[model samples]
Target chain A: MVALEFWFEFASTYSYPAAARIQAMADQAGLTVVWQPFLLGPIFQRQGWHDSPFNLYPVQGRYMWRDLERICAALNIPLRRPSVFPRNSVLAARVACAFAAEPWLPDFVRQVFHANFAEDLDITKPDIIQTCLERSGISGHRIIERALAPDNKDALRLQVERAVALGIFGAPSFLAADELFWGNDRLEQAIAWCKVPSLVGIA
Target chain B: MVALEFWFEFASTYSYPAAARIQAMADQAGLTVVWQPFLLGPIFQRQGWHDSPFNLYPVQGRYMWRDLERICAALNIPLRRPSVFPRNSVLAARVACAFAAEPWLPDFVRQVFHANFAEDLDITKPDIIQTCLERSGISGHRIIERALAPDNKDALRLQVERAVALGIFGAPSFLAADELFWGNDRLEQAIAWCKVPSLVGIA
Candidate 1:
């Protein structure tokens, strides 16, 4: 089975849904999903946005929240509007980057999203991410130490650079053999593209 | 059955697919699709985007064109990258707005899209839109006169304002009553919302 690279940012609202459901969907289609966690701050800044585009344009932001609510309702996922619009996820991303190949990375990803979006908790604090790590069935102390190490932080920075090289401009992007599909809405289509690489591509 | 309002801008690439396929999908769902032609220029300007966000941000633009190619290929719709990235569609939009209630408005919409995307013709010109009108089985001369009328022009401006008021920041947006769905990707979900409004919405 071909691998689908699931590139996501922890602070992205759309990535929350993509993180929650991508694995099961990919498994059914016989695709292996590579959970790529990266920060959107540098990426957005490169595109001349100092903040989430949603916050910059409140009208689109309003529609986005409404759309997200509908999507969450359809999927039966619990969501609460985060008190802090987009919580800092640098340390969380570093943890995921440091252990990208871990068997329990997916669980940790979901747990962090749950903390921020489902529970409306501030994910930036070390204690919250520590709780998330514990919830993902891993002891928090050692991972947090390694996650804050210089090497892991550098790895996370490079991950954002690599994402830009692959033409990913937003979170919840899927890369199937260099074909990029953006947004949670394209996850199923990305899975299908992996299933039959020839059927739905022009490149 | 509830009605689904399709809001489109002629220069929006995703709107091409939505315009081509929305009518049939709405028909199957026993829903009436009210075609709304609006300009995205004023809306984007208000949001501080001087050009199509796709163009202003080239990475996203690259993905969009490739994604559009994939979609058009999958749907067996002919596509050619227009010489202009986003050809001006003000006049075409006015033509659409002017004759929106006519039975042939849908055909005219498709023709204008084809002229710009498939045929690589300038849709902003009077001749091009007149050709589109004739292809839709309507006489072009008087309609162009009416479309270019000051009142019709103002109506198109008001349409864009109405779109902004509804929190629409992008093209190919669907409204099931007051709920908004953005992008061609959401067309199916929007239709589903129209079909069984309660099952797929929080609003």
Candidate 2:
């Protein structure tokens, strides 16, 4: 089975749906899912944006919320409007980064997305992410400690760099055989590309 | 047959594919295709943007080209990189607005998109738009004269304002019973929404 890299940002509005349903979709297609958690702040900063593009453009931001509401409802996923747009996701990414190699990382990532988007909880706070870690059946205290460690912080930073190197400007990006697909809407297409790399004429 | 309003801008990159395929797809789905040609320049101005968002954000701009290449390839559509990022579309839009009530409007719109994207022609030029109009079997000279009339110019302006009133922030947007779906990727979903509006819980 070809390995598909699922590059996501904890604060991405679209990533919530992709993170919620990607694993099962990948499993059914007999593809190896590599869960990659990264932050978009650095990437946005590199693009000279101090905040989310949605915030910068009010019209686009308004449309995005309505679109997200309809999409979540269609997917039968619970989504509460977050109080903050693009919440500080450094901590959440670090935790996921600390456990990227573990089998439970996907579940933990989904839990974080759910807690933030479904519950409207602030993910920047340590306790909220701690709760997500616990719900995923992982040691919350040990993982949080490891996640906040200097080494883990550096690891997470490099992960963002990797996303940049791969030309991922937005979240819920999928990398299949070196071809990049951005946005949650492209998830199925990405999986299809993984299933048959030649179909897209990607050499 | 249900009517699906295809709201597009000549300057919009994604609108190329949507315009090219929308009529045939809608005909197959037994839906009426309403070709709405509006300008995105005023819409972008209202959003405090003077240029395309893709150009404003370089990384996104770069990814857009690559993504467009793959997408056009997958759809078997010929695409040439336009020398200009977003050619001025006011002239072309006015022409569209002038003859929108005519039956051959959709074909003319598709021809214009093909000229801009596939042939890399400058659509802002009267001669080029004239060529598209001739290809669609319309009187190029007469229509061009009517299109540049002051009333037709104002008509195009009001069309843009109507787009803003409808809360449309991007091109290639579909309006089915007032529910908006943005992006070419959502074209089929928009058609589905039109076919079964109640299933999406849109009242």
Candidate 3:
């Protein structure tokens, strides 16, 4: 069976919708999903972007907000625009890295995405993150502390570097083998590809 | 039965994928799809954009090319980067407008999108467009002539103006009732929303 990897950033709004739907779709298609969470701050800084591209372009940002609302409403998901643009996602990414091997990692990532984009919560705050982790019955402090460890930080850096090497510059990216699908909307195509390996390398 | 409108532009890359798949998906969902082709130039100009957002941002443009390749491969679709960036789509848009009510309109739009982005053809050339129309079993001269008619030009402009009024600033936008889904990736969500009228206007 072909396995698909979902590389997401907690600070990304579109990742929220992708995360919420990817697993169910993958299951229906009989594919394995690997959740890989990485911070987009490093990538954005490398590109000299001070904020999300949507925010950098006002028109794009306006359309994005409305688009997200329509998607959430159709999916029957609640959403509120975050007040703080581009909140610190380093801690969240770290927690994700530390729990990558755990069974609940995917769920944790989805919850964080929802918390930040749907509930409009500051996912970077210790209390808010701790509460989110506690709700999932995990030790937030332990996860955060472990995430800050030298090895874990190095691993996260390496992950971002790999993404750069793989030609990825955005969130909600999917990797099916060597192919990359960027954006939340490509999630289905990514999954569909996993069902038929013969379809790879078409052009 | 609910009718959903798919508004796409020829210069849009992702629209090729959605245009190819939407019909099959809509059929499965028991929904009617109204294919609407409109020029994105007016919309972009109205929003103060000189080019596609991808072209405006270098990093985005580079990543988009790579991402499109990966997606095309996964979908078993042929794709090649267009030689010309932002080809003058006026002729193609006009032709599309002329055939908007015809059954072959969807195939024409799909073929043009694929030809522009996949085959790397010069879509602005009348000969190339004429050839494409001929291959699709449509009258190239008649369509082009009708496209230039005063009424058809007015209709195209009116369609673009309507898009601006709807707050759409991008191509590949899907509208189900009053709900709007932006981007090629949102095709599925837009179709799904059409199934449940109660979800409309909730956003």
Candidate 4:
């Protein structure tokens, strides 16, 4: 079976739809997904961007929200526009990294995405992150405590560095071996590439 | 039949593929294609960007070139990397706008794209644009002369302003009624939206 890394940012609007469908879609293609959660804030800072590109360019931002609305509707996913353009996702990302090895990590990611994009809840709040964790059948308090550990914090930071080293500027990005495919629309293309070993020269 | 406006910039890499396939695809889908040629340089300048976003962000830039390579190969289209990151497309765009009402405008647009991206020719040169025009079976010198006319120059400028008024920040964008879909990947979705009359409330 081919293994693919799904690099996602909790604050990314497009990542919501990708996180919701990737696991099930990967399973059907007989691909194994290594869910890698990282922070996009540090990455954006390196690129000299203080805010999301959607917010920095007003017209593009306007188009993105409408595009996201249409896409979510087509996917049968309910969307509730968040009051904030990009909610602080540090806590959510850290907790995600804390439970990176857990089998239910994907579930946790999806729920957190839902909390931010569908429920219009603040993802930065510990209470909200915990609620997302608990809803995913994980021990919210325990994981949140572990996630706040210095080592886990360092681990999350390292993950962000890894994303930068891999030349990823956006989420959700897919990596089949060393090849990177960005955007929610590229998800199917990434899967197709993974399934066809020749595409990645794996065969 | 439903109608869609295809807003494109000559220097846009993604627009090359869209321009090559849009007319045929629209025809097969029983939709009318309104080719809107405009310059993205002015639009980018308004957002404080003096260059392509692909160039403004290095990592994204690298990924885009690689992504375009793969996409073109998948589509079985020839791609020649231009010596310049973005060749001045002013001349090509003006010529396209000049022939906007002509029956062979789509063919002329495709040839210009073919010249710039596929053939690595400078689209800014009148000789090159003229060549593209002649190859499309249109009068090269006459069209080139008309394209450089003062009135045609103002017409192209007006089109760029019109694009901004329509909330278009990139190309190639598809507009079905009031709905805007950006990117080549959204082509089929835009077509589908146009085909389903109820989606546009025409039914």
Best by DockQ: 1
**Using Cα atoms with residue i matched to residue i, what is each candidate's TM-score against the true structure?**
0.97, 0.96, 0.79, 0.96
Top candidate on lDDT is: 1
lDDT of 1 by residue, A1-203 (tens): 68999998889999999999999998887888898998889989987899898898888788888888888888899999998988888989999999999999999999999898899988888899999999989999999999999988889989999988888889989998777899998887788788677644532
- Please provide, for model 3 over A125-201, each residue's C-alpha lDDT reduced to its tens digit, 9 standing for 90 to 100: 87787877877778788777787899999999999998888777899899886677788877766776666534463
Score chain A of each prediction against the true chain A by TM-score and list the results.
0.97, 0.96, 0.93, 0.95
- Model 4 per-residue lDDT tens digits across residues B86-188: 8899898888898897998998999988998999998888888888888888778887888899999999999999999999999899898678889998888
The 10-residue segment of model 1 chain A with minimum total lDDT is: A194-203
The CA root-mean-square deviation of candidate 1, after full C-alpha superposition on the true structure, stands at: 1.8
Provide the RMSD of all predictions against the true structure, rounded to 1 decimal. Answer: 1.8, 2.0, 4.2, 2.3
Candidate 4 chain B: worst 10 consecutive residues by lDDT? B194-203
- Model 4 residue runs over 4 Å out of place are A197-203, B197-203
Per-model tally of clashing residue pairs: 0, 0, 0, 0
Off by over 4 Å in 3: A1-3, A20-34, A66-78, A102-107, A149-155, A192-195, A200-203, B20-33, B45-49, B54-81, B102-111, B114-119, B136-139, B142-146, B149-155, B200-203
Candidate 2 residue-wise lDDT, A38-120, digit = tens? 98888888877899989988778988888788789888899999998889999999988989999888889999999989999
Ranked by TM-score, the better of candidates 2 and 4 is 4
- Cα lDDT for residue A90, candidate 1: 94
Q: Of the pair 1 and 3, which is ahead by lDDT?
A: 1
Question: Which 10-residue window of candidate 2 chain A scores lowest in summed lDDT?
Answer: A194-203
